[model samples]
Target: GSASGGPDEAVRQADRLAKDAGAPASGTAAAFVNAARELGMTRVSLATPYDEAQTETLAGYLRAAGFDVVRAVAGGPASPAEAAGWNAEAQAKLVREAAEPGPDGVLLACTALRTAAHIPQLEVAAGRPVLTANQVSVWEALRLAERRVREPALGTLFTVLPPVRG
Candidate 1:
């Protein structure tokens, strides 16, 4: 992160990962916001493993996309294996600690965080729409999933609210 934390480089990397994940591209915070708002969201928080500067730049991009930046959490361990195994109790505590109340959508980011399992509970605890890295991953590629894959365990988005009519 060049203190500058190249947004272009970051987006390029995200684009490659989206391809690898079999997801659509537009692969930046703006793309994310558009897709999310498609599902009725306006406010979001970030959860990622980066130094402060990189996290802030991401926060900036989201804001540019018209998303309200509720919070920007920086640095979680670097990979999915590491993130998935994170103590749920501890992670919950961290989320509670880092979270700041706002218009009602807490985003549990980090494509590696494997947070779907916790979304429902988090929403109950936080009292809002809870978005996670994996959820967004799927939403960003509903067209790819092909058949309808909505389920209660997936969070309010698929399990509950109607998808954005665009």
Candidate 2:
């Protein structure tokens, strides 16, 4: 069955490791949630290459992190290698199909999906911001490091600075 709390725990563990290593902690899950919030996105659609259970788990994590997952679609790839080989056209098509009405953004889940290469096109096709796991991870790392995000090719998520920390 799909479960929750794993992502939250992962974030906690990353922070703990960073502290122990005497380095700045970069909480990926928290950073993803904050990225959505910074973009004024409270609702999002999701596309993944995992099976149903994994999709459900990811949706649950996103919901727990605060965004309402309005829709989620799984591509059900047989292997990570196959998923990684999925062309940008296929990825964009899946994203478009999963993009239902009322979603503030579209999330192309799974780092193995090779989504970073297609984020700009997907965003334009979906008419909204498109986020991928690797993209979000990089964004979070930059934000936690107090660096400005400015990669226009990665879509709007990288165009603006993260919310100023107090």
Number of colliding residue pairs in each model: 2, 0
- Model 1 TM-score, all chains together: 0.68
Candidate 1 RMSD to the correct structure: 4.8
Instruction: Please list the residue runs of candidate 2 whose C-alpha ends up more than 4 Å from where it truly belongs after superposition.
Output: 1-7, 162-166
What TM-score quantifies how close candidate 2 is to the native fold? 0.87
36-142: candidate 1 lDDT, tens digit per residue = 67567777776565557667877786776577888877755456677666665645655664466664466665665656677777666556666666676676566
The stretch of ten residues in a row with the least summed lDDT in candidate 2 is 1-10
**TM-score for each candidate, following the candidate numbering:** 0.68, 0.87
Give the best candidate by TM-score. Answer: 2
| Per-residue C-alpha lDDT of model 2 across residues 36-155, encoded as one tens digit per residue | 877889999888888888888888888887778999998885478888888989888888878877599988876677877668998987888988877887887776687875889988
Highest lDDT among the candidates is held by which one? 2
- The collision pairs in model 1 are 49-75, 50-75
Residue 94, candidate 2: alpha-carbon lDDT: 81
